[model samples]
Target: MDGEIRTRFKTICVYCGSNSGNRAVFSDAALDLGRELVKRRIDLVYGGGSVGLMGLISQTVHAGGCDVLGIIPSALMPIEQISGETIGEVKKVSDMHERKAEMARRSDAFIALPGGYGTMEELLEMITWSQLGIHDKPVGLLNVDGYYNPLLALFDKGVEEGFIKTSAREIVISAAKANELLEKMELYTPRHDQVASRTSWELSQLGYSKPPI
Candidate 1:
């Protein structure tokens, strides 16, 4: 068990915004994250795009001679500037659902960088999946420049409000920097059963009749 826990993950799925914000720090952090992933010899699994922070990260990883795998929807391919040829592999899908599924399938862990609604949606789905025992992968948030602080507080509020399980909160590891976040993830183990139990309890609190499985 110890050996398995300590085993290095081969792939990580990164969710970041397609638009680089006004702050240059966001881009810098993205680059640092990319370089660190390469330093740690981890493969990058991401949305296939060549713009904004996503492109910056992919370019950095490729320049560092690390493996990068992209999954993109066919419709948004041209818009995202899909650089299918430069990366290790690119899998084009029919829609957003397929893209997310493919990305999850290819990754051992999930990380969210500064992003918009799309990125948040992807991260949330992965977290829900982990809670439901669909997957036992670690999910991390790179809170660069306190970008995710508000969201973190909101998550805590959910727990307080009885909407989100406290144990589910433990499943997400948060860090202000890339290296630290990755280091913690290196030691992550999914607490799916705990989360699922908590979710069940939360459901019961809502007075919803539990269906016999």
Candidate 2:
């Protein structure tokens, strides 16, 4: 166990869309999450981009005097423009795979806001890694504006279809608002058996040899 639940995590990884959604509310939610992170003195770990919701969240956190660490691929550096120099360190990596790996290594928890395919990719990778016992960090979804309701339902469907175990689904805490989700994260304790069991079962079902961890 990670011991006592700290009021503020040292760093939290946020996965959000590179493009802000059509609704102003989505932007508002992003801003709110940023402010909340700042108020708690939690550092932000994310894709180093200065566009759309990604920029909004990072900038807002910076404005609130919170630390922001960005890990961006070298290719996107020219496009993302890297935000505030005063907030925290920004490390440019060779590619997207490296970017995601570094961000995961740096964060204590993971939160996914409304995003597109890229965001989904990041979140799923985190989940898979957690399932593999690569890390025991907490993972959550900020279901702002009911944005993730359908996806949540789909996860439930996965459980029903036996493609995903109920225990694996339980690893992800979700809330319609940021504060609630953060609270749940503070209380999180990863279930190692659940993670191991699912990984072993999935590997066997796929007829693939499970790699020794």
Query: Tens digits of per-residue lDDT for model 1 on 1-213?
Result: 111223377888999989998999999999999988877777798997888999899888888776888888889878887445555577888899778777877788899999999999999998887787556778999999999899999999999999887777888899999989988988886553543442344333223254212
Candidate 1, 134: how far from true, in Å?
A: 0.5
Clashes per candidate (backbone, < 3 Å): 0, 0
Regions more than 4 Å wrong, model 2: 1-8, 82-88, 192-213
TM-score, every prediction: 0.85, 0.85
C-alpha displacement of 50 in model 1, angstroms? 0.3
- Candidate-wise lDDT, in order: 0.81, 0.81
CA shift of 210, model 2, Å:
22
Model 2, range 1-213, lDDT digits (tens) per residue? 222235758889999988889999999989989988877888899887778898899999888777888887888887777444533567988888777777876788999999999998889888887777666688999998888899899999999999888888888889988889999999888764534543444333222355322
Question: Residue 157 of candidate 1: its Cα lDDT?
Answer: 97
Worst 10-residue lDDT window for candidate 1 reads 204-213
